[model samples]
Target: RGLKFVIRKVTGRCELQRICHNNKPGARRTLKIGRPTYCLRIILCQSALSAHPDRVEKTIDDIMTLKKVNPDTNPQLGISLQASLFQIVGYRSLVAEVEKLRREPYDCENPDHEEMLMKLWKTLRPDSPLTGRISKQWCEIGFQGNDPKTDFRGMGLLGLHNLLYFAEHDKATALQVLHDSLQPKHSKMSKAEWEQKNFDKAIGYSFAIVGINITDLAYSLLVSGALKTHLYNVAPEMPSLSHFQQTFCYLMQEFHRFWIEEDPCDIMEFNRVRSKFHRRVLRQLKNPDMALCPHFAASDLHLVNL
Candidate 1:
């Protein structure tokens, strides 16, 4: 008789059921299922997330007919379904776009790629001059080697894109974080203690490397649909690169704080700390109302609140 009962009878926990249920007055109990929502996507081709209004309406109609939920009696439910469907399609579309960028290698030959890299350097290190593209000066900002291009191996352009977004938009926060990252993690360690225990001579974590790794983390969460709760709640419309980038900015800053709080003995403990952080975020996303970046509004991370 109810929308949830009818939907489940037709198809065991449809995407709408998995995504739409929340603790609101007269609303069905929340179903924290992820598999069914994605199973719905697998049934439809990639183009099913079409931006065209007619196609979307058709899809909604098809769902209504299949689930036997009358739009007249369940007007509020239908509206909720439409919003959930938008999140599904929006998240899928974002994955496609981000995957395209991830697959693309960082081509130094491409002037555009090179320019973006240089822009990142200049933005992060305003006073410090870049001696050359392949210079060791790149290390100052957390590049692993003389040639920073190699570090972009797995993340590719997406890594550069996220880093540059952080530098350009949140200049003050980004620069301050970079400066902090460069400081030797252990303040009280003497030269003899440093040798006694294999410790980093300077810089706790490579800022650029950690940013790229965090990008990968964000990408993983997005692809796995763990971010759906955040996206669905934060953005009423479609989620885009801007949403993803803002998430990156949030993660990068959060991780820096997390690192300090954890008081990691060495950089080798990175994986353990990162894994813990990932699990904590996953737990947070399990809540339907979770918003990772901005719990209130959709903005370009004024960052002060964060």
Candidate 2:
């Protein structure tokens, strides 16, 4: 005799929770039952499954095969097993995409990259003319040294891409942040005195260099899967490089504001302030429904409490 399965709505969608088996001879069965039938008590997210019907069906098929092959296996493991399979696939895909960008070393010899670099500089300083090689103006844009190439060594092309994206897409905001980086607010001092103090301090804070470092931080979050919670929610369809770039933008702006507010006494304090900021971001990412929208307020960057 076959078994009769009962589907009931729990929470929001139909779930298969119980199976009634009939052992009587010549009994009409509602559903075909294999030998050693087991009751499944899986509670999958009905809405999520509906959104991805094909994928959910495939996952269910795989689970069904396991039940057939291992009749003695616990049916309670079905829900978690299916969920883990999806998560593993998502993690691998996200990591692969992130790694592709991380491994792409910036090639100075590439004409396209060189042109894009020039474009970035020009966007920041419209009055400045493009140069053939690295110049002192590179320092004006926040490179650590005369040559900007050395700064890209740690972050590779991902750093440059983020810089160019910000400059090209949001020139006004980008220029404003760059200008702010050069001038730290002074308390209880005249404008002339502040300028003199800035000169005396010479803390060597470069806007462009710091932006690259933030890119590294953002990349670390993605690589470490700390970003998966937010990314999964924000990009339910398919996360891409653009989503990562958006995160870079958020970090760049947020860090700039945080730096000004902290007003570190010297550049040596950079590491300490940066660590604090990184921890805050990680805390926000811990939320399951967190999403980093482009228009987030500087003061309210924390995830919404759900």
Candidate 3:
């Protein structure tokens, strides 16, 4: 009875006491991505954020019960801990929220969503203003039909968002890649041959549609454990929205290069070449030093908190 009493009184280095002592949750650079651990499992099982900032605090409270340490001992512990944990585990939420965005369908009814889609057009085709929402001009950027919303089927709004992010963030590269995609395989061909081939069918690729497809590839890397090598190395602190976007940028550029290098007969060779490119990326990632972002510039967390 005496030993048990003492045990209850003395809290361990769990949430409550750790926070009270002002434990530095400084950079968690050593966190191993992909492989699940007992601690993370505990965190996931114990608490979840309920769609607000307060929920982050509430999550701390949930963990506090497990430690049995009095919050009153250090009045500031609760507030400080919430802020600290928010930074520490916020990347998990970032990934979850991003995945949620993937599941969210593109709503043409939502003005905000439409604005984003429009921004993609303006960014890519600045000189050519879209005459109407349903104009065939969308195909200039590489949508199959006059309507682009249909192109974002399985990927949803994330497809559009990623395409926009690539266009907006890496404008020069994105535009150059788009320009290259518009080029014909047989540049020296006569007008007669070009006319017979059909311009759309003769182009190297479709930039906007391919961006969405690459979004699917990036999402695959995020969900699967394959991206850990590049992600772990690049974002040593934590992954953020920009990190994912930067990955998308890298992929778009790399794919463009890869497509050109393969010297495909036509756009029909996309799948065969993309599969080969995927294999090449997988092989490169097997080396611990491989970084998708050629330069280590995607570390800025200011775009949005992770």
Measured against the true structure, the TM-scores of the candidates, in listed sequence, are 0.79, 0.67, 0.70
lDDT of each: 0.73, 0.62, 0.68
lDDT of 1 by residue, 149-236 (tens): 9999989999999999888877788888887776666677676755453224454688899999999999999899787767665666
lDDT of 3 by residue, 75-103 (tens): 56566556544444555655686798889
Q: Using TM-score as the measure, what is the rank order of every candidate, best first?
A: 1, 3, 2
Best by lDDT: 1
lDDT of 2 by residue, 1-306 (tens): 212322222321122223212211111111111112333223223323332546655655654564453324545334433443344344446567667766777788989878878887888989978565767767768877667878888887778888988777667778888877666444554677655534323433677888889998998898887877665555433455776777788788888878878878878888998999999899987655566655433322343332
> In candidate 2, which residue pairs clash?
none
- As for TM-score, the candidate ahead, 2 or 3, is 3
lDDT of 1: 0.73
Cα deviation at 16, candidate 1, in Å, is 6.5
Regions of model 2 farther than 4 Å from truth = 1-91, 184-204, 296-306
lDDT of 2: 0.62
Superposition TM-score, candidate 3 onto the true structure: 0.70
Q: 13, model 1: CA deviation in Å?
A: 16
